[model samples]
Target chain A: GAGVSQSPSNKVTEKGKDVELRCDPISGHTALYWYRQRLGQGLEFLIYFQGNSAPDKSGLPSDRFSAERTGESVSTLTIQRTQQEDSAVYLCASSFGQGQEKLFFGSGTQLSVL
Target chain B: AQSVTQPDIHITVSEGASLELRCNYSYGATPYLFWYVQSPGQGLQLLLKYFSGDTLVQGIKGFEAEFKRSQSSFNLRKPSVHWSDAAEYFCAVGEEGGFKTIFGAGTRLFVKA
Candidate 1:
């Protein structure tokens, strides 16, 4: 893909339902990131994937939030038992490499937990 | 902990008027700063970045940002505002040796014709 691609541009779900957001990063990019943006809030770091190394999940807010990536390609963010506060925009970005490099972003998945 | 602050939630400007968006960050050591713009129903696009050297960094769409380490600020500026420039602007900061980048709340620019 020319740029980072994300799926489920908009989603509305009942509280406690699980939701999955997908991201397809640019080819040959080795770094992927997930971020969350609440209404009228800044972007919150969720997690980071660098190569085959263990993903840096330090930013995950809770156990319900989890993500996975395969071979530096497509990535998925799964939220289990979503809460009303989970309604926000989930953004995905990828970079050629880590360490202060420029990141390419996707349009993001707008999730609304009703 | 690293954080970014964009005080202006919304800014209105006339076409051809100069614009400035304020940003402040909190990070230890050298900081990697970036400016991104997001138009309605569009993905975020990188405008410019300041990693090291050259406090003044030029970016696309006639946008530029100046990194002031002393004040912990990286402000985005444009000499002339265009209708197309109406968008949400964000300032971000990345820590050294860390892949995670923190973004500001964003400032929405409205250009009046």
Candidate 2:
């Protein structure tokens, strides 16, 4: 892909329903990141993956939120028993490496939990 | 912990006027500074970044920023404002060798005709 691609640009579900958001990073990008942004708020880091290593989940808000990436490609974020507070734009970004490199962001998936 | 601060929540400027947006960062080491803009319903687009070397960095859309190490500020500037430049701007600081990037509450720019 020319840039980061996210699936289900918009999703609406009732509370307690589980949902999965997928992200396909740009070719050859080694670092992938997930961020959550509430309406009119700044981005909140969710997780980060560097190559095949264990993802850094330090920013995940709770146990209900989890993410996984295979190799250096596709990644999926899963929300179990979604809450109203989970409604936000989930953004996926990829970069060549972790440090000073610029991040290419996806359009993001807008999740709405009722 | 690295953090960013955008003092102004919203700013309005007339078209063709000069514009400046302030940003300050707090970090222990030399920080990786960045400016990003987000249009309505669109993802954030990088305007510019400062890693090292030159204190002044040029970016796309006629934007530029100066990295002042003494003040811990990376303020974005443009000589002339355009209607299309109205958007939410964010300031960010990335930790050294770390995956997390802390972002400040954005500043929304309004360009009046």
Give the alpha carbon lDDT tens digit for every residue of B4-108 in model 1: 999999999999999999999999899999999999989899999999999999999999999999999999999999999999999999987778888999999
* Candidate 2 CAPRI classification by DockQ: medium
Q: Write the per-residue lDDT of candidate 2 for residues B1-113, one digit (tens) a residue.
A: 78888999999999999999999999999898999999887888999999889999999999999999999999999999999999999999997777678889899999999
DockQ of each: 0.84, 0.74
Tens digits of per-residue lDDT, candidate 1, A20-71, equal: 9999999999999999989887788899888645458988999999898888
Candidate closest to the true structure, highest TM-score: 2
Off by over 4 Å in 1: A52-54
| Worst 10-residue lDDT window, candidate 1 chain A | A50-59
Which lDDT tens digits does candidate 2 get at residues A8-114? 99999999999999999999999999999999888998898898564578889999999988899999999999999999999999998746678999999999999
User: Which TM-score value belongs to model 2?
Assistant: 0.97
Give all TM-scores, in the order shown: 0.96, 0.97
